[model samples]
Target: MFYISCTYKIMATFLYKCRDVGYDCGFEFSAHSRDDLMPRIRIHSRYAHNIYEMTDEMKKKVEEAIKQID
Candidate 1:
């Protein structure tokens, strides 16, 4: 598991309640590696609180988004 601290300079968007790697608090990712892909994201599990469980729709979006990668 990776831990990422977010700031405006590095964090362009904050998706609340996102579900993929595990649960959801605020989806924090780094575009530095996935800049070439659609809504490129690198998930982080550094949330201060427990991530809310993922819903079916949210899970699908996350899985789809992740599958687009190498």
Candidate 2:
């Protein structure tokens, strides 16, 4: 007799929308994890919105705005 095992992986897509953070801009970003999405958001905030630094409040807002979809 022989036995076999199979494994499956599910990936969650993390999404962030600028509007969710009170921005009127229609910028949307998606990544596999928050770690990956934040850097891109930081760059966009600096270049597009002239946000040189992310305040603790802003970081909390951003984190709350992130949505995860599987």
Candidate 3:
């Protein structure tokens, strides 16, 4: 008799909402990983909100607002 084993990996989607970060705009982003989501958020912040540079406090707020969806 022979036996085989397989493994499956599930990717969790990361979500960020502009409203979560105190923005009235209804902007939402989702990515398979946090690494990918952040760049998009930064770009949006720069162009839409005129946030050329994100301060440490803003960074913390953004981090706190990110959610992981399975």
Candidate 3 lDDT for residue 42: 95
CA lDDT scores, all candidates in order:
0.43, 0.96, 0.94
Question: What TM-score does model 2 achieve against the real structure?
Answer: 0.88
Positional deviation of residue 23's Cα in model 2 after best superposition, in angstroms: 0.6
Model 2 over residues 1-70: C-alpha lDDT tens digits?
A: 8989989897899999999999999999999999999999999999989999999999999999999988
Q: What lDDT tens digits, residue by residue, belong to model 1 across residues 15-43?
A: 32344545544554433233432243322
Per-candidate TM equals 0.28, 0.88, 0.87
As for model 3, its CA RMSD to the true structure in angstroms is: 2.0
- The prediction achieving the highest lDDT against the true structure is 2
lDDT of 3 by residue, 14-61 (tens): 999999989999999999988998899999999999999999999999
Give the worst 10-residue stretch by lDDT in candidate 2: 2-11
- The C-alpha stretches of model 3 lying farther than 4 A from their native spots are 1-7
**Full ranking by lDDT:** 2, 3, 1
RMSD of each: 14.8, 2.1, 2.0
Candidate 2: stretches off by over 4 Å:
1-7
lDDT of 1: 0.43
TM-score of model 3 vs. true structure: 0.87
